[model samples]
Target chain A: MKMTKIVRTTADVFYPFCLVFGLYVVIHGHLTPGGGFQGGAVMATGAALLIVAHAYEDITGRIRKTAMKILEAIGLLTFLFAGLSGILFHRPFMANWMAQTGKLFGNTVAHGPNPGDLNTAGLLPLLNVGVGIEVLGGLTVILLYMLSGIKEEKKP
Target chain B: MTPFLLLQALILLGLIVTGALIIAFKDLLAAAIAFAAFSLLLSIEFYILQAPDVAIAEAGIGAGLTTAIFLIAIRGTKRFEEKE
Candidate 1:
């Protein structure tokens, strides 16, 4: 069963906010309190909001299960590659080799506390993005699977 | 007692109350909602304890995703508990 129009409308309005906020959390994970898992769960919460507001058939068209599966795979690959990159650089696995090297996400910072820089944490932000998307895809796919189970139960 | 301590106490009391409510409710939906409230209070407690990371995780997973999952499960099953 679908929710009321008001509920759907509210979910639509808040969906982008959730997505953006979750992205912010993921991107700023190194400098902020939340990290990949938390941010991804927040984004998944948005997906859940949308899924709960609409019917299964209606939602499947917008958020295909195959797409979610692909997303999950991509995220895992990204994370694995990011970790494996340290081996290529002759460092330990998942090393922060890029830090203080004056490259992308490698800027140096002062010792004391102050406004944080986005380019300060090397490898961490990349790992965060990887994990964030992985959790999002995984959680959303679980919900979709549950919903599909409900649909199947009603059939026969 | 300090105001911070008072606030913490109040939140802890709320946590216990909500925890009990989750068990006491006959309607599974109501129990799920109470669980959400319990999660929220626990997140707040985490924040006040100087662990914002745990707080954020708790709020997102415990308060948000878990509640949605529970609601979906209830939708698939019965809303009210069956008598033994």
Candidate 2:
């Protein structure tokens, strides 16, 4: 295969791996180091790769810019809601509100027989997910807009 | 002599090199690519420094979104210029 073809094939394989790895980082954020922001950025890179390798028209057809914008906004609102709900409940902002004591996915997070279990922890995980989605969607929208703009410029 | 300190020193060196390269490079496109690398390295440094939240934000906003914007801007501008 030619160099360009090789690059395209590698990107095609790498995109799925990036997406899966990104999800793993986001989901296991509580126990591990990576979180939503990092994961989301990683995920967005997959989209970036696709944009770089494939035609703009093809990417646009699959990923609607308007929908991505809406999703991004919703993600931000979800994060805000999670934070404010803690304040409304007389807890600190972004406090851990979940049970936090039980076992989650076979991992003993917080100590048992107490309210501070890992499973029942506050809203950090949820917040992480929200932030991840927001970052991914927002970046996608920006990239798409820029690409479309470039296409339009080339046409005239 | 500790491994942790060694890692920190390496990350700091990366940041400095990236910053210098960004300033020294004449090509805006190259600088923009370096900027993304800078962001990623800085995020790693942040993680090592125990500031995961800031690191995450930097990785996403700085590395991901900012790079995309820069590339777009570069496409809109002249590709090359005489060195001054």
lDDT of predicted model 2: 0.79
Q: On residues A60-133, what C-alpha lDDT tens digit does candidate 1 reach at each position? A: 99998999999999999999999999999899998888888889998998788988999988899999999999
A1-156 in candidate 2: lDDT tens per residue? 123776778879999998998887777676665788888888888888777777677667887898889889988999999888888778887765553434433324545443332343357678888988897888888889877787778876
Reference contact recovery of candidate 1: 0.77
Model 1 lDDT per residue over B1-84, tens place: 999999999999999999999999999999999999999999999999999999999999998788878887998999999887
CA error at residue A12 for candidate 2, angstroms: 2.7
In model 2, the runs with Cα more than 4 Å from the true position are A1-3, A87-95, A99-120, B1-14, B40-44, B47-65, B81-84
What DockQ does every candidate get? Answer: 0.79, 0.55
Task: List the candidate 1 regions with Cα displacement exceeding 4 Å.
Answer: none
Q: Lowest summed-lDDT stretch of 10 residues in model 1 chain A?
A: A93-102
